[model samples]
Target chain A: MKNNFRNSKLLVIEDNSDHRFFIEKAMKTCLSEVSAIHMSTEQQAIAYMDSCLYQEWDLPTLILLDLYLPNRENGWRILEHIRQMPTPINQIPIVMLSYSNQRDDIAEAYQKGISSYLVKPTHEEEWVSYFQKLRSYWWETVTLPKMRFSF
Target chain B: MKNNFRNSKLLVIEDNSDHRFFIEKAMKTCLSEVSAIHMSTEQQAIAYMDSCLYQEWDLPTLILLDLYLPNRENGWRILEHIRQMPTPINQIPIVMLSYSNQRDDIAEAYQKGISSYLVKPTHEEEWVSYFQKLRSYWWETVTLPKMRFSF
Candidate 1:
């Protein structure tokens, strides 16, 4: 059998250029072959997601959502929009990656139904370690639904 | 500050007593300190969850659901039930453990919003490794919403 994740793509929604640079760097180091799309704002994310619905596009295998685009509320807004998308699109696992460890933010993220919440690391090396664990779980250990279907 | 998971509890809902035994054994070997509650039937699972609402019961930090109580449809039934429960109760991450790897089953499990899908290992040693990866992701690396809230 061939590798199931040969074409897996990760969609990252993060606005901070610094964080975005680190995310791509980490993915390149940890899971080099997994292509990623970084949308720096809520509007870009919505437009790209909407475009996927209309055009022949390969929907992302997983989503990494940054909890704030200057405001945490925007995180909730984009998450709601994605969750409300049709069928398997909504089913795509959205792991929230945020710098905030505030109880209210974590609690509310769960209340609104994020697949998992990860506290963003501070240093570049720590970011690599973070993605290593992320890769170990999502890529190596668990079976992802995205590998099996497309429309 | 105290360890957040000081009082964390795991809820395992499996109809097979044999599988139940293995799961418990794995938890002890890997995460001995975390208390576990195992329910052997769908009714028991529902009763336990419902009772938590009225009593001073501790809500499970994580739920491990057996794909079938002899039939796969039962997994969906119980999952939908739990997903509809009130507030943070519905927010608890439910990891579906199953022997079936049918594309349809995996796809539908995601469609229904399972936190993740794991394939049940056939050997005792493999089960431990499975739980090890599980522990690595869910326990050590990621920040679960469960550790932070209560009704």
Candidate 2:
């Protein structure tokens, strides 16, 4: 499984510290060689992407972004910030995270070019199971873009 | 599981007769309520999208497109065609299917705005496993856009 995800990376942009820690740990449980970069704010997330571009290091293969707004229209602003980037950076797959199951929210995310919409789980165990399913589907079944090292 | 995929739909665009049949069967094995629309040519695929728009029936939630060209340059033309469409239609997730594991192929697909790239498995059993993982990841974990009834 490690060989399958060779050169692959993940970027998680969430404001909540507990969620940021919980997500990173859950992902590690599913994939042994996990090393996810965490960004607590939208600004930090954007800066990380820019740093990747400027440093010549490869971008993360997947991005998990949390919806930030109190109202229904969450994640769009941050998604737009990332989408406004240049070239391949803008093309990276982003999975938008939210706490709602409303059709309108999913519809809006789809319209905004979000790769996938994920509802935050209620319990911690569900997070592990979620990452396991994600591991099998995304890491094993899917072919991701090539990654290059800075060195 | 049936309720999870309530109004969701799938479009499979593959030239090979066996693979098209195989993918549909494999998907059905995992998801009890499976109804996949198959198209043999790029034109047929495009027409289906147009028909969905004209009829006001929502488009498929996911699309599995085969890489046609013998060289690495495949699936881009069909991808471009779909992307040229307006609104949510163009933003629908399209997974590129191929038999190659080359990084270049995956990179190109990502660059072309493909949601994901999947390498077609060799054995028949692998196909079933692939669909099962797909079911778990896409159907259960991901919150797909709401589907509409034509009537």
User: What is the per-residue lDDT of model 2 for residues B1-151, given as tens digits with 9 covering 90 to 100?
Assistant: 3245766677888888788778878977886565687887767877888887766455787888888743333357778878787765776788888887777677778767777788898888888887887778788788766555511
Report how far off residue A52 is in candidate 1 (Å). Answer: 1.6
- DockQ-derived CAPRI band for the predicted complex in model 1: medium
User: Native contacts recovered, in order, as a fraction for each?
Assistant: 0.66, 0.79
Weakest ten-residue segment in model 2 chain A by summed lDDT? A68-77
Q: How big is the positional error of residue A137 in model 1, measured in Å on the Cα after superposition?
A: 0.9
Clashes in model 1: which pairs? none
Q: In angstroms, give how far residue B77 of model 1 lies from its true place.
A: 2.2
Report, to 2 decimal places, the DockQ of model 2.
Answer: 0.68
- Each candidate's B-chain TM-score, in sequence, is 0.90, 0.86
Worst 10 residues of 1 chain B by lDDT: B142-151
What tens digits encode model 1's per-residue C-alpha lDDT throughout A33-67? 78898898888898888777765356887889998
> For candidate 2, lDDT tens digit of each residue in A71-123?
43335766877677776677778888877777777777776767788888888
- What TM-score does chain A reach in every model? 0.92, 0.85
